[model samples]
Target: MSDTAREGDAEGSGVSEGASGRTDAHESGAERTAASDESSTDAREPPRLDGWPLVGNTVEFVRDPFGFYDRLESRGDAVRYSVAGDEFCTFFDPDYVEQILVAENERFRKAQILRDSAAGFAEQGLLLTEGEVWRDQRVRIQPAFTPEKIRGYADAMVTYADRLCDNLADGEVVDVGDAMSELTLKILAKSLFDVDVAGRRAVVREATAALNDRGDASGASAFLPDWVPTPKNRRFERAMSDFESMVDDLIAERRTGDESEYDDLLSILLDAEGPDGTTMSEAEVRDQMVTFLFAGHETTSLALTYAWHLLGRNPDELERLRAELDAELGDRRATMADLPDLPYTDRVLKETLRLYPPAYVIFREPTEDVRVGPYHVREGTNLTLPVFEIHRDDRFYDDPDEFRPDRWRDDFESELPDYAYFPFGGGPRHCIGMRFATAELRLVLATMARELAFEPTYDGDPDLTMAATLRPENPLEMRVERR
Candidate 1:
């Protein structure tokens, strides 16, 4: 890891030294005074990265977001950089991350960029809503994710995994990413809506691909105006329209059926009431469905995809995983009851999440001027919690980039800082489906490892793309070998 203190002291670095250090070179005197009075401390502005005129750091960031954030880590814990004309402060220190996500969470709101991007699909859902709306939605949706409810979904998860494994032929080359996406989507459909999405898989896949293209920061669509007739934007609109139609069909079908016959998440949303004794509106229900459908399946599939990729490259790890599965679940499918004895399987998933977090970054904006460490951040300044960069930081883990599941075998997590390994994020706004996703990952991995092994069809690392989720830039092809 880079020396945090030494980086701040480097010549020409924008980071201030102490509470009494001078303000950022660009900060107006009046603005600096207001920040000092708000915090009643001599907090200076964080370090700033120099970029080209007008475009700023947008080009570099668009070119390679992971590399861009990695470069920022060498500047200081808190570094300011711009994308296009918009400025954002990224926090690298775990303590500051905790403050932003947990300690002083109320002082920040979900970043506007995220809201704008998601507005096309899930505007009123738990992912984008704020204040009363978010709180109520979370309250209404909490019951479906309780420990008992999640455990109940394990059978369906394992069943779907077995189905996928059975469909694959020995020595057949497969697009592992697509296969995982299909498996998780099926698992999610059954667990969340109590329906089969076998027929709608193509639509979901198309819509998800379009969403990724539209939301990807590395693409030109990200910087263009919404009204602009960009090719990607046009495709996104068509895909969303089809996707919304599918959601409407699901909702309409459920509305016409006996509500008491179903006990999945869709039914919960349909029957839930707020403190005011009102149920969600039609549009709100659609938003919730879209939110869960996208968020729930997409992240878990990516986790499984990356896990397969990593395990395929590491034969020793693959053998270890198979040994654990064979010992715990020999010739039988995995169940929730067997999770405790499958510690190695759990560690493999954890290691994969650390290396390739689906939600790479969490964006938040301060609601008011606040002091973060020795830095004075103004209200509405974008705060980025780079989960991807932090996960791979050498400061937190030894050989951070290597895919070694056994690293999690000891008290490593117990000794790590709170926000150092937050793959699902932290605080009040963390991923609500965390438990569900983890359970799905472990069960699917166990079932697949028990019956088969994967061998990579390509060489080196598959190129990675960043958007709302971290995914491979190309199809991750692998050969399916029956164990």
Candidate 2:
């Protein structure tokens, strides 16, 4: 997919300029602040929208995040607000997003809100850590997702997808969202651990759902101490405990068996080392395993669910995709080798990811005082990168909301700036499993298109839910007909 970069260097006057958008990159500490003094929105602090006494915009945000942010976008490039006693800056510009994630990444760190919310569930996994430790963990984890390693996982993904379809009959109505979730989880377990998690799928699914719900709640009251046992908090604890036990058992099973027996992500991680020449402890390994289970499966499942939902509504796109699949692999299951020949199918999935990115929004906090555009941001300032808004910004995409796979036909993505459509994110912290997820998504979409025809049970868009990842609020129910 083509991504057109905006003009002007990111380093010019410490401002990253896109086609029309501009954001200030927090350069050398003192110099950046000096430059910000001359900016247009030169205020003592970022623009703040007034709110209630203590809760700030928490209620409105919890009630409807997308709508709240969409409304906030009209106010300014960056809007500061208080939430549950703390302050935050919500950035709508892609240039600002890029600055925080790339050019001046060192000045920022992963938001503590996420770490506190997921701590019990994910522990000290790479997703939560920062600084040298995070860098080391990333180095250790990077090799597992290398191109060669991901290509090795394609067959397992396709095999599991086929297995999920085996029991379905033509014209049978099924919850594609639930099915995709289950299928991806199974694929994750097999692909990562070389184990069948189908037996424990119920436990894993239930636990994950509870955690996501609790996480959403946690975001609203992040200032609350973790020891407080609210009813919801108690339930979340139980779910995390259950998941941890399962992971511990899985690790134990591997320990007793031959580590040399399988070549999976678990094996690689178990043997991976930090830059300091230290191997990961078993507990650390368990944390990473759980992280992969959720991150690996949830996002991919959402992509598949949306792909089918969009295809059901857009027959022309569906036929075009099927045409590519038919022309490439008439009657056989799609393999990694067939990726080059499946360009249209690739575009369909790409478009789906753009419209419905699972990791839709990310939060970061400045390690020190910083400058974002004309605003002077203080240390410990919470910054939110609203990727969803940027992806749909009409400044970059012609019909920002439409599902047009044909838009990706040639150098479309290449024509846009990097942060404009980062479904998997970008820069040093870009998702390590991107290549793996891409391969899995394309193969599953291709395989399903070749095997079944999907018809949506309900018309219009599916209700969206933002858990840890964005997903359909309800089951994406569809009637399936065999090809």
Candidate 3:
């Protein structure tokens, strides 16, 4: 089902994986000495592996990247895999990441694969756009996520978080993941639109979930053009239609002057002006709203999922977090003004994101022939950096798999290199809502930690899944007990 061609060897350039243990750039010609295989430092090729036939390693990849990475790293870091008739590779090495996001960024832009693939849902929003458009949108829209604006959203963020905690009865089993999703959606709606969007949350959630399905691009759905007729196409269309309809209604309602209208992302986008002084149109506003909604609602919730699961297993970290909150809030509430003081809470979030970055591959295309790490990428080639694998590398992190927040505590702060822990991505095109997402996360975490504690409901080992976002394969069934 998933493609697994001879992914190890790249186009007759035989990168032999042998017992001799040489895994690095294989030299082939003059004036180009291959990268030395630093055995003591790293031996993994990149993050890619050569797969078989037309299917490449898609099937293997969809199953479990962690396991796949373990095997690939055992052989070498960078392994080449073919997909969709293209020679694409996934990279876990930080040097490659730096090349893609920083050093050679001007030459590499977001690959067209994601842009065209995601065309089903939304087109050319912040995520898919390239070059000038992305630059302009980011510049105009970034100011809204300034610390001051995030601070403004904090009170409402705390309020919704506490309300979520309050609803958690001592003995009831709850899905913390789903609860956080809903909580964030509400917070976004109220703080941005000044209206409670509980009525519209489900349709939005369902539509969003559809966008995450890798299956849409697989099976029968893959055969059809994005606009063509098919189940996946229909699903994509309906979701897009519903999301836009909601935005249109909100905009119309805002035009008529709802007394409740407040200054949130929607308002900020609508009011944002490019250097040329052109404000975003209603359609642009809608796209930006969904983009922020996808980011604001989904990523923060998934981060919480990983954080909760890790904390549940680590009593020491849990107790430390509780102590931090108790000393700061003293059973009151996580206030906007108090955000500056919660250092440990921020540490937990950073560590969670470091361990389980919500974004998978940050893609870019080469504008010119360039070297990512060891691979000499020609122009028009697409490059992807797997943030998930890189974050867990022992090189950047000590005992990488272990859930230790203290890794980010002392010298680790100064030690964190650029592109090392890019949960929000990097470059000029990095997420504009980074500050906002952090603000939302802190609010929800503090409020929930004060009142509710989640105990996972799984009987055996925890399950991990990589759909649109990395999460527990099943709904996070957990007992939500009030403290």
Q: Local error of candidate 2 at 86, Å? A: 1.9
Please give, for residues 339-433, the per-residue lDDT of candidate 3 as tens digits: 66888987888888877777766777766665555555556655667777778877788898888887777667546554567776644455555
List, residue by residue over 302-402, the lDDT tens digit for candidate 1.
Answer: 99999999999999999999988888877887888888799898889889999998998889998887887678887887889898888998988999999
In order, how many clashes per candidate? Answer: 0, 10, 27
* Residue lDDT tens for model 2, 122-164: 7768777777776777767766666677778888999988887
Give lDDT per model, in order. 0.81, 0.75, 0.66
Clashing pairs in 1: none
How far is each candidate from the true structure, as Cα RMSD in Å?
A: 8.3, 5.0, 9.6
> TM-score for all predictions?
0.91, 0.90, 0.84
Q: After superposition, how far is residue 384 of candidate 1 from its true place, in Å?
A: 0.9
Candidate 3 to native Cα RMSD, angstroms = 9.6
Q: Compared to the true structure, candidate 1 yields what TM-score?
A: 0.91
**Candidate that beats the other on TM-score, 2 or 3, i.e. the better one:** 2
lDDT of 3 at 91: 64
